[model samples]
Target: METRELRYFVAVAEELHFGRAAQRLGIAQPPLSRAIQQLERRLGVKLLERTNRTVTLTEAGSVLLREGRAALDAVDAAERRTRRAALAATGQPGLVLVTKAGASSELLSKLLDAYAAEPGAVTVDVHLCGIGEQERLLRDGRADVALLHRPFDSTVGFDTEDLRTEGQVAVLPAGHPLARRAGLRMDDVTALPDLPLPRWPGPDGTYPDGPGPQVRDHTQLLQLVGLGRAAAVLPDSCRAHLNADLAAVPVLDAPTVTTVIAWPPHSRSRALAGLVRAATLL
Candidate 1:
């Protein structure tokens, strides 16, 4: 029933001799014989036929010899693998940056491209999900780390790095009056006929000089602006128009969107720390 009893039974079974098995196991013969007897008593099976002149394995003893050796071998392998994994974790395992769907498209691609340009450095993988969902994954330990345009709450169990700052530009129809110049001052687009903005963070009136009309999403607002239906200011990284006639011009008064890479506080994993280090040049 117990591992030590199985070990003793295996040794005795292999040798088919009492004194030699005990000597090999570095145990006394009396205790070794008693251990084998206890094992058979527990299993309710006779394992060996023994006499003062000779010893021989029974049917059950042969089966146990094969299984016991396999069990001991498996235990040894498991212990070794666990020790190796612990060492690797202490040394800082390789990283994967789980980000919001839009965050990676903005900066993560450049960061990885730079990292990959150097052939021999440590590797990091990039993943993306919605901002709210990614935060949940980090909290529940389903994900090792996160990066997003939005701030992460402390209760979500994360440390964050505010890598860099950038501003958004207003997307307007190419033929619109504001789009004629290379860039427009905040005053130029602020007075547009009708402007659309995404519904988030705060009410549409949150802007000091609230634009008259607003749409529910940025990309859609941009498409409307390109079609001369409306105008809106959005993050520069947002490409509302690629082939159609729309132009993005800088908006001077808009606040910069801060991008962050966040992870659980003092995680057993070093995914966040490693990624932040590799991204220092950013």
Candidate 2:
């Protein structure tokens, strides 16, 4: 199917209402409906179930929606990468590296220093972003490489090198009784009735239903912990950055976090290769 038709169907599938999807696409409702119908005919499947007052995706529609989003993202990445290539051909060229803010601080610094010492090293722009934002940035070509922490970040569809693995710690209010403990299990922190764990945004940029305050980054979550409003479980390295108001205890049962340097599988840039090499060496 053509990109335009895929886009239209995706919009409709997501919004579940032709009127809203048409408005989102900045078009009239009738042509949008016609496009969906034509696409369904061409694909020989019922994409949507429409009623007088509601709209819903058919089994086929759900699969198309998932696949279409990936296809569109690939197209967008290709266009952006091509434009960047042209710019590199005629203008100052650089690399963009993205990672979650307040993560991998010491490792990132050492990696940067190591890469800078290499001969013919290009300027590397570092982007510190909110939770669940780095993967999307890398996927859409807005960033060249990323420092992804897994089980938190997915490394699918990319080439990655394992950097290091560390255990997790529970960050809590310093004055809380639990903060004085030698170590805690996952239940000790997760089931805290008073200091509910903070909810982080998912890949879809929506927070899961929870009782905790929605947080966007490590800094924000720490501030909340300091204020006795919430708690967080993060990589053990975070303990080094805790202040007087916040305390960290080893979460013995939490899964280990693995930091990986990731780039698109198709990348062949010498500078990117050098950066990844430096990271692995670190």
Candidate 3:
């Protein structure tokens, strides 16, 4: 019921091992086990099933895990917003904008230029983050706005305006057979046994189970493609950065990626509003 209890429960639920969870939480194992027991008693439900070798969640634990995560995110957001407000009260003249590194470079340039040209624009601090990090940054008040690519990034809890949309391309080695084709469909690239698609890390930093090499960003993905080690589907704008060894072919059936300017729904800063307006008008 309390935030501390929820935190402990979430940690144990995630790790499924009291010792590991305790290590993660910087506390002793027995105390962490006791806290979970106390939490279960207070709720009058068996949250975890434990044995000599393994620990697993019960049905109630599964439900509580989901809801408790949301509750904790809300608490973190509240604390971050409060701190941000206190900082702003001291007359800081800037807003932090976050975006995926190496993405939407041209659009970002134009957006920054347009926003700077506004009559009362504040200093804009741009933060380049790894994939899937922008949403977290925005939710926790580390960033005031973000440029997110739809279908790649979730916009569930924010307000967004479409900036641009473009089709995807398959990035391959210049000498590959597919590189000579004028165009291709998704089927042309997906099942290439010789060129497995690279695996990207999920938000939790774990690579999905796959046969391909794991990559963290577009740069690494391109390098892999250039080495003929992997193939990747990327937004068309990425072609601007491709070297001669890399070739891009339009994937006729791939979904179009829409770049959007997103912000927290409850944001009330005048500078953030101005920046969003500037982006939309471009």
How many clashes would you count in candidate 1? 0
lDDT of 1: 0.65
Q: Where does candidate 3 stray beyond 4 Å?
A: 26-34, 52-54
Using TM-score as the measure, the top candidate is 2
TM-score of each: 0.48, 0.95, 0.92
Off by over 4 Å in 1: 1-96, 102-106, 114-125, 130-133, 150-157, 182-193, 201-230, 239-244
Q: What's the lDDT for candidate 2?
A: 0.93
Q: Residue-wise lDDT of candidate 2 within 30-88, one digit each (tens)?
A: 99999999999999999999999999999999999999999999999999888877767
Best of the two (1, 2) by TM-score: 2
Q: What is the C-alpha lDDT of each candidate?
A: 0.65, 0.93, 0.91
Kindly list the per-residue Cα lDDT of model 3 for residues 86-141, writing each as its tens digit: 87778875889999888999999999999999998988999988778888888877
Model 1: lowest-lDDT 10 consecutive positions = 198-207
In candidate 2, position 118 carries an lDDT of: 90
Q: Give the TM-score of candidate 3.
A: 0.92
Q: What tens-digit string does per-residue lDDT give for candidate 1 at 142-237? A: 555566554232333357777766777877777767676777666777666555443332311243335444443444555566677766666677
Model 3 scores worst on lDDT over the 10 consecutive residues at 84-93
Cα distance off (Å), candidate 3, residue 209: 1.9
